[model samples]
Target: MTAITRLTVLIPEVEPAHWWQCARQNRSGAVIDRALRRHTDAVVRRLRMRS
Candidate 1:
């Protein structure tokens, strides 16, 4: 069996355009940074497990 972790970001109150603009401008925002870190960590963990 395989286990998968899914992370979802919800910003229902924010306008789509504005949210996208902010994300584009601040790629290193806390939320974005955390998500990226989690994703990278998952990939690295998988690779290590395979070796």
Candidate 2:
């Protein structure tokens, strides 16, 4: 099971409105989670490739 954690962020005004739109269509948290996971994985892959 993936352990859920809390994150607090201060984003720009435009971002919140975008997130609200995403929330209306689907789960905003899921959208954010997938984006974060993909970005993190990409960064990790890059670092590993450098080794």
Candidate 3:
């Protein structure tokens, strides 16, 4: 089971492991096109698994 580690009322795409995490973390359907580095992808995937 993915334990809710983050305390933010935020969704699953905000405040990523870096600056280009995603711009839509605040809004629901913003779709921030900032391309995250490859390393960022790994982190986000790990986080997703935990969430």
Candidate 4:
């Protein structure tokens, strides 16, 4: 038997119309964007360390 490890990133689904509206007038878009960037950076760092 083999052990398996998995990482999953859950990105919220935002409708294009709603996204555009929030991006234009709300800070929520910026917060979500920052979180995504941080998550991506951590994943990349882990991949590099493994290699």
Give the per-residue lDDT of model 2 (tens digit) for 1-51.
999665443222222344346444434444555576666542211111110
Candidate 1 vs candidate 4, lDDT winner: 4
TM-score, one value per model: 0.24, 0.29, 0.18, 0.29
lDDT of 1 by residue, 1-51 (tens): 999886544322232354445554432334654565677643221111110
Report the lDDT tens digits of candidate 3 across residue range 5-33: 53222225334565554553454322222
Q: What's the distance in Å from true for residue 19, model 4?
A: 20
Taken over the whole model, the C-alpha lDDT of each candidate is 0.40, 0.39, 0.34, 0.44
Scored by TM-score, the top model is: 4
- In candidate 2 the C-alpha lDDT for residue 35 amounts to 76
Which has the higher TM-score value, candidate number 1 or candidate number 3? 1
Pairs that collide, model 1 = none
Backbone clashes in each candidate structure, one number apiece?
Answer: 0, 0, 0, 0
Positional deviation of residue 16's Cα in model 2 after best superposition, in angstroms: 22
Across residues 1-51, which tens digit of lDDT does each residue of candidate 4 receive? 999665554434343444445454434544665676777643221111110
Of models 1 and 2, which has the larger lDDT?
A: 1
Superposed on all Cα atoms, model 3 deviates from the true structure by an RMSD in Å of 13.6
Using TM-score as the yardstick, the better of models 3 and 4 is 4
- Cα error of candidate 2 at position 23, Å: 10
- Pairs with steric clashes in candidate 2: none
